[model samples]
Target chain A: MNTTRRSFLKLMGVSAVGLSLGQLGFDLAEAQAYASKLKIEGAKEVGSVCPFCSVCCQIIAYVRNGKLVSTEGDPDFPVNEGALCAKGAALFSMYTNPHRLTKPLYRAPFSDKWVEKDWDWTLNQIARRVKDTRDKDMVLKNEKGQTVNRVDTLFMMGTSHASNEECAVIHQAIRSLGMVQMDHQARV
Target chain B: MPKAFLVDTTRCTACRGCQLACKEWHDLPANATKQRGSHQNPPDLNPNNLKIVRFNERMTKEGVVVWNFFPDQCRHCITPVCVDVADMAVPGAMIKDKKTGAVLATEKSAKLSPADAKAVAEACPYNIPRIDPKTKRITKCDMCFDRVSAGMQPICVKTCPTGTMVFGEREEVLAVAQKRLAFAKERFPKAHLVDMEDVSVIYLLAEEKEHYYEYAGFM
Candidate 1:
């Protein structure tokens, strides 16, 4: 289901109207501090899925000015019912952490230092290396003379961050190259 | 009506979702931690971490190992001693949001002397409230006032997959706590609510408070 920013704000407005303040007999002086607006008040809600594990909890990403500001479990998603585990709860940090890599880093076979590389160069290098490795390691037959189309040395490590469609495409691409050694970060 | 939190520890699995979710909402920095031979990282609550899942392990007399997970945070007491102490030093340093019963440390808290901040922290029965050495701002859980004010659940309660944390009006939350206590009593005879009358954040312990944490209850 799609949730437009206007519709989401309308829903929030209803809940906000139900809340009342300043009846607990305490000094009303702090009311000014409490009146500050919510951080995600006007942010747009974009639905996404958690990439941590098989749970695949749905999350609502709050976007403000085209930038992701916050994230929380989607309340309408029945599977999680707006709940998330520790790994899933840290989804927001995954975007904001300074340690996260923004650009690709490459290192030569014997070089100890990693140099930053652009996406175009990184993609071209990866394609070149894969073709070279597959050409060198492709095996047509086993010792028993059985026909087996496989690349014994070219291994592909899959990531959970890849979507289902991306994974399908990746699987097909690798299989066509006769790459047999495959693993996923989520499972191992 | 004032708000309250009912944390049923019996249902907690120590996933620390609440701890991490709280940090994510506050945008707090990560702490440098080393292997402490346990899952409890960073040792204790610092300015960066206002909430933490405390792990306590003990060997029973019958040679059984008992592990208890206590998700700890500021209790937001009904009559907060921290507020009193903080106010004595700086008038608007610490105040309570009457609508939610959330004890908040204001920016004025930074005006407090280091000694006065320590006194405020010491006054808390739950040993919450941390003093940031850099900003000198006394910090602790504010019950996610920004969210609660918008008629939303606190991030910690909303992220708990175990349904261990329930937030709502005080009376309704107390009823839920009592019902949970009744269910808990069937399996763990010592199960009881922790200082429900004194604090907005209530905990239902399956065993004695000592098995949970040293300051699990005001005692």
Candidate 2:
């Protein structure tokens, strides 16, 4: 039998306590209590909503020393009533994770590398691409001679992160450009 | 009065909100993991992860596959075996809080030798404790002692989208567990509460213990 030193130490540890339990007549209720320190005791709470889905569960982000300490569901919100899904519960990581992108990244048509681009440059690039695609693909009319304004080459994908007012504004802008291929990222 | 938890497995959708919430509360770092052909990640319990949702699939006699999810963590047993084991090697390494019945691994656990720490972890019947290779301190769920002591619910229970986890005074939680068990029995005749008398975390399993995890319960 390989008693090896590790298992032997473990065996002695277990049996030593087994004998001690009988000696002390240990009762859990009488065990020594400890006063624990709360992790968010002095942190500032900032209320926010989960951006993962339509539920939009409210959350309280605890920040201490200008850094996020903890995050949890907000009990006051009626939509989720303090309940959150996996993605919502993991909101803290999204905010603090090193891997998360803090700036816009752009890749050229055939480039094998991604380049960090400023917000102004990225927005201008998107606007320029949209204008070019719309001008090249906008259809004037259908085969039956009905006036139809549509851009087949351009597709617009929106996200649940947008508010109702923002969605309305975005939808109007996309429609005005005659982009027919549009979809919302959220189903529920 | 000591506090307790009532986990109704029938209500768990396996969304893993509680698992992630635990990590968020503890501020544990993320694990660099690859897909194991299942949604379960990080593979196994470690010093970094104090809680995890275990996924298992079993084939029923009806020829349909039944899935089971057990949100696994330390049970905080009424008489914790790990504490006893730790006390033998290093006196203050482990402690059981009288007010909340929360068995905790103290910072003094770093004093235990590698052999002694492994023994302390190995003594746990539920196999929960994880020893850090660097610090050699045994670690596991502390019942969110800091949160509960501050009059806030455990983050895991608070973030559960489904009413799968419940925490309250021990008696109140036990009553809730019994009521939930009765309700679940109608759908799953085998529904029962796991280790209610022995541990603070009372699990209302919807199926036999085998369906969940091999260590889901002890007689």
Chain B: TM-scores of all predictions: 0.99, 0.98
**What DockQ does candidate 2 score?**
0.26
Please give the range of 10 consecutive residues that has the lowest summed lDDT in model 2 chain A: A21-30
Indicate the residue-level lDDT of B133 in model 1: 92
Q: Once model 1 is optimally superposed onto the true structure by TM-score, how far is the C-alpha of residue A75 displaced, in angstroms?
A: 2.5
Query: What does the lDDT read for residue B80 in candidate 2?
Result: 92
Query: Candidate 1: which docking quality band?
Result: acceptable
The segments of candidate 1 whose C-alpha lies over 4 angstroms from its true place after superposition are A1-10, A13-35, A141-146, A159-168, B113-115
Q: What is the lDDT of residue A29 in candidate 2?
A: 29
* Tens digits of lDDT, candidate 1, A1-188: 59854466467766774655445334455555444567787789899999888668999999999999899988888889899999999999999888889999999899999999999999999899889988898899999999899998888999876778999999999899998889988787
DockQ of predicted model 1: 0.48
Report the C-alpha lDDT of model 2 over A4-57, residue by residue, as the tens digit.
543453454445334422232224322222233456766787888787776667
lDDT tens readout by residue for model 1, B1-219: 789999999999999999999999988988888998988876889999999999999999999998999999999899999999988889878998766789999878989998999999998888999999999999899898878766688999999999999999999999999999999999999999999889999999999999988999995
Candidate 1 chain B: 10-residue stretch with minimal lDDT? B144-153
